[model samples]
Target: DTTVKQNPRYKLARVGKPVNLICSQTMNHDTMYWYQKKPNQAPKLLLFYYDKILNREADTFEKFQSSRPNNSFCSLYIGSAGLEYSAMYLCASSRDGPETLYFGSGTRLTVL
Candidate 1:
């Protein structure tokens, strides 16, 4: 199959809590796309092939996947989204890092 896949295609996460997401490729495809979508909200861009694979579709395309004129972000904001809002904030990705790096009390994203 030429399909890119991520496990638990559908997930359940607490509104303000954390969730575990597992991704796998049956074909071991070259790339995988992780999309976070909310009810009635358009699919938001995540990242890209990340290995510098260029987009040949329109020639100058991106996101992770992007194209917007959305009216969802207000001054307070949600008149929609913008091309500038296409990434994960406070996210870290490491595969070959030191395992002894966790010596902290912890991390918590406080919303107030």
Candidate 2:
């Protein structure tokens, strides 16, 4: 199975503090993606990696930061946490793109 694993299923972050979420997969996929989801809203693509290359969405490019330290691991970093940032973050991996996305359960971040 091509499964993506995310750590810290739930996270509690203080306002203005930094928050970090992790994602990993053993399938050796060439691409990984990060998305943010909220109730009644569509999942928004935050960033993604094509092998060692990183790509961020035009609108959200500055709002989110990511790093793929290695082929099997990727991280989503939020420089400063805010109430508005509280949402379900999804990590996915695929051999290509959306067509084969294998998503993790997600990490729910709550800002206090």
**Candidates' lDDT values, in order?**
0.28, 0.94
Model 1, span 1-112: residue lDDT tens: 3322233333333334333333332332333233444436654434323223422233223322322122110010112334333222211121223421111111121211
Q: Alpha carbon lDDT of residue 89, candidate 2?
A: 97
TM-score for each predicted model, relative to the true structure:
0.33, 0.95
Top candidate (TM-score): 2
Quote the positional error of residue 40 for candidate 1 in Å.
2.6
lDDT of 2 by residue, 2-90 (tens): 78999989999999999999999999999999999998999999999999999999998887899998999999999988899999999
lDDT of 2 at 112: 97
User: What's the CA error at residue 15 for candidate 1, in Å?
Assistant: 5.3
- Candidate 1: stretches off by over 4 Å: 49-112
